[model samples]
Target: MKEKYPNLHRMALDYLSVPATSTAVERVFSQGRQLLHFTRNRLSGNSVRAFLCLGSWMRHDVVSPEDLIAIIRQKRKRPSE
Candidate 1:
């Protein structure tokens, strides 16, 4: 098979030897699905791209849900007299 498909064999060998798994790819795709669930039938190309970028960053720990929720709560709170 390698002799018949040299490029594919090389690609397979390279992938097998890489340190990174398909986990990141799966995670990003999962996030994209989640983002699309609520926005299905209404998302533009740019909107989808933005969501994917944001989702990828979130997966990479650039943002925390707790902090986001706290900020939202603070903004929604009325000022004390």
Candidate 2:
């Protein structure tokens, strides 16, 4: 990576402040597992995806309602190309 993009390598090193490992992400998945075990219902792939995404977001800091609305608006404007 340094050889390919020295500037990018330096920038990444400076910008990335979070942990490199996926340990936090794995904990989120563990929460999903516990939820499934308690519910005991066969969840479809899409439902699982939604639950995981929601759970991750919920566990983190709350986004302002206005920020969420703006995000939805921006997402809607993008062409499906």
Q: Candidate 1: where are CA atoms >4 Å away?
A: 1-19, 58-81
| Per-residue lDDT over 7-79 for candidate 1, one digit per residue giving the tens place of the 0 to 100 score | 5565555345544779966876787788788749589989887667545445555556787678779988968
> Given candidate 2, what's the lDDT at residue 16?
53
User: Poorest 10 consecutive residues of model 2 by lDDT?
Assistant: 55-64
Clashing pairs in 2: none
Clashing pairs in 1: none
Flag regions of model 2 displaced more than 4 Å.
1-19, 61-81
Q: After superposition on all CA atoms, how large is the RMSD of candidate 2? A: 8.6
**lDDT (tens digit, per residue) of candidate 2 on 1-81:** 789976455545433546568996688578778878866678987888666654444344333456767988999999988
lDDT, candidate 1, at 79: 85
